[model samples]
Target: MTTSRSTYHHGELRQAVLAAALDVIAADGPGALSLRDLARRAGVSHAAPAHHFKDRTGLLTAIAAQGYDLLAAGLAGAPGLRERGVRYVRFAVEHPAHFQVMFQPDLLRADDPDLLAAKERASAELRTGVAGLTDVPDARTAGIAAWSLAHGFATLLLTRNVGGAIGDDDPEEYFRSLTGLLFSPQLDPHGGE
Candidate 1:
């Protein structure tokens, strides 16, 4: 896969390595990730990715950090809670590799400062969206429920588990309808059903 003899000599080696790693994860899942394979895919020596990431967990941490940053951006300025949830699902669908790595804390260096910061940023964005529910006494619970709904739906869609159940309906459209149900007073835990 060597396109140029001096490929790694360029300053973009880290980006190339990250891109290659994403391709590998998309093709074979994160468990198959290896710095050696990434280096090969990036047309560089085996040590190239290692120099950049140090180890597999380190690389996964970087990917997770990037995912959270993207998620925060996607959730930013959403008009309401439902829109923010939709954005979360859209982000997951559009960036499966990053999404996969981001949630599985066990697969990443959870102690990494950059990863922690990114995670906090994403969490704050979600909290902001949930805070829009003025009637909800506990914003934390609402935030978790919102996150669960979006994350579960995104996982189902990505795995094709929804199949033809949604027919020709856009996933986002279906999610919007579902959000109405979720926020309805009848389903409220403290509303006595």
Candidate 2:
């Protein structure tokens, strides 16, 4: 059941609107998001969203920042680069709306302090994951390669580009296997040359 507008306390309205925005983005993409539509979905007045987000960019910026913080947390708990890559894919799959907004610089406030800090935290986590691999000749290049592979796979999965090929297999498990192929010997810290 949906909460009525009258029932939302001061701060709850902001969360409610954000949740509603996520639903809209998940269902219809970020291009379909509108402050007025979010207000309607949240059962609030048209001006309600403006009170919190100020504008559409402001709302998307909030989502992007939240996404980065979530990504950082997910990566932090994983043991190694492979697991971190899997966690990154898992995050993108689970939070498609946030994932969509987080990478679209045109949809966000590039200079927003919160967004910048959150992005850096997530990047640091990725770098730390790559740094764990002692065999890598260049940590920076390795990190980029890992991120590209993971992000590309996640994007393909999200877009259903590989659905027919993946069939009923769990994407995460499939991803884990694929990573194994790439990381088996050369990238594995414990493996012999």
RMSD to true structure for each model, in Å: 4.3, 2.5
Q: How would you encode candidate 2's per-residue C-alpha lDDT over 1-193 as one tens digit per residue?
A: 3568788888999889889889999999999999988887778889989999999999999999999999999988576777787889999999999999998999999999999999999999998878777766788888888899899999999999999988999887888778777765445453211
User: Which pairs clash inside model 1?
Assistant: none
Error of 2 at 39 (Å): 0.9
Q: For model 2, what is the error of residue 152's alpha carbon versus the real structure, in angstroms, after optimal superposition?
A: 0.4
Taking all chains together, each candidate's TM-score versus the true structure is 0.91, 0.93
Give the whole-model CA lDDT for all candidates, comma-separated.
0.82, 0.87
Off by over 4 Å in 1: 7-9, 185-193
Best candidate (score: lDDT): 2
Q: Model 2, residue 65: what's the lDDT?
A: 95
List runs of model 2 lying over 4 Å from the truth. 184-193
Each candidate structure's count of clashing pairs: 0, 0
Alpha carbon lDDT at 79, candidate 2 = 68
Maximum-TM-score candidate? 2
Report the CA-based lDDT of candidate 1 relative to the real structure.
Answer: 0.82
